[model samples]
Target: WAIGLLEVAFSRYCPITFGIRTMGLMGLAYAHYSFWPIWSIPIMVYAFLPQLALASGISIFPKISEPGFLLYLFLFLGAYGQDCLDFLLEGGTFRKWWNDQRIWLIRGLSCHLFGTLEYLLKSLGISAFGFNVTSKVVDDEQSKIYSQEMLDFGVPSPMFVTLAVAAIVNFFSFSFGFLQMICGSDDNEGLPLQMLLAGFIMLNCWPVYEAMVLRTDKGKMPTKVTIIAAFLAWTLYAAAFHISFSK
Candidate 1:
């Protein structure tokens, strides 16, 4: 997120500092914006916002009958289809393409979220940030242990927890929207796209679900992480509900 912001910022401020330059430099600045920060930050922040609003009886997302909703859906499908086509054109297998998609979701929920938060907190002078150098060398004993264990323990706990909570929240949101549609609610019309979005997130979260519920390997999500994620998701829903009623 910072990289993207910095690119645009430089584009704007560099001209004022060093007089006007070619339009090519301006284009270069904007074109250099990192895809991860440009898209993933917004995805991380807004993934559940509209659903939370709807849970609170607030209509923020577009209804299925609305042109905006169709546009949004088409935009998603078009980008996704294009990506798939690119992968196939490059001779990637279906399974590899699917794994790449899931990895994108995982990185968005975990690394992108952390990166954005770190950037903001540092900018606000609330936190200190610096790069730390680590050894690249690996010993045979340690390498063997890591290979044998296949543990996800190397990842920071917060990242795992964030990923788990995102999966759980999306799962619950999709289920809630599904149930509402099945019950024939008047408000179901506005929920289709939201539900579809949630369901898409949930589908990409299959690995997390497997780790949380099915896997017995060392790579599985810990019991504490599952408990924490479930609690956080419930708390978010409860808070949204309370706010809606209070309003």
Candidate 2:
């Protein structure tokens, strides 16, 4: 559904629709003609809910008006609840699984934000370095050290640069939005929802912020990466200011 929305939006923005259609055809071929397992009916229905809701400007059930909080509650239950169920099915206790899954909330945000940065970099002609497999065969001593300290970041990479930039951006965005709310600025009223959401997202990203700046362990961002990230962030802010104010 996300891909379909993107296709529709892009088609509306640009005159060229051939590429979008071709990509959609390729995806269908891979799913149906290739070895990929066809998605179950329930999975397809669940995936279409968000797009359907957006198109109809209502929840899945048309008879129910003003879904409001119930919409968000059901969305969360349909999504993350399945993961919780899976953990229980795998012989994991609910209490322990719930505690462990709390970290993934932050991780999901991190992955999406960094993934956006990666796409942005690619658009600017930067080639992505392929994925590296993390070693899972650590010794007992190494495991203990990692548990007490931080994950190893001995090698500097572009991924770290992206993460640092995102952390700094979230920090300042949340801080400024919070200050505006506290000051009771008129502008805050106009964008209260956005400001509150930014604050919530920043809270979710607290762990990334700690790893980027606060932690002084081997996993902490290197000085050079921090500098580059700060510079890129400043450049982006300056560009945004120019575009907004030049009008």
Off by over 4 Å in 2: 1-142, 148-150
lDDT of 1 by residue, 1-247 (tens): 4434544444544433332345545644444443345456677765678667656556676888888998988998999999999999999977779878877777777766666666666657786455444455666754764676332533337678878878888887777777887889888778877777778888778778888888675556878888888999899899988988888
TM-scores for all candidates: the values are: 0.76, 0.51
Candidate 2 TM-score, true structure as reference: 0.51
Candidate 2 steric clashes: 0
**Which 10 residues in a row give candidate 1 its minimum summed lDDT?**
12-21
Q: Pick the candidate with the highest TM-score.
A: 1
- Compared with the true structure, all predictions reach lDDT values of 0.70, 0.50
Report clash pairs, candidate 1. none
Determine which window of 10 residues in candidate 2 has minimal summed lDDT.
Answer: 33-42
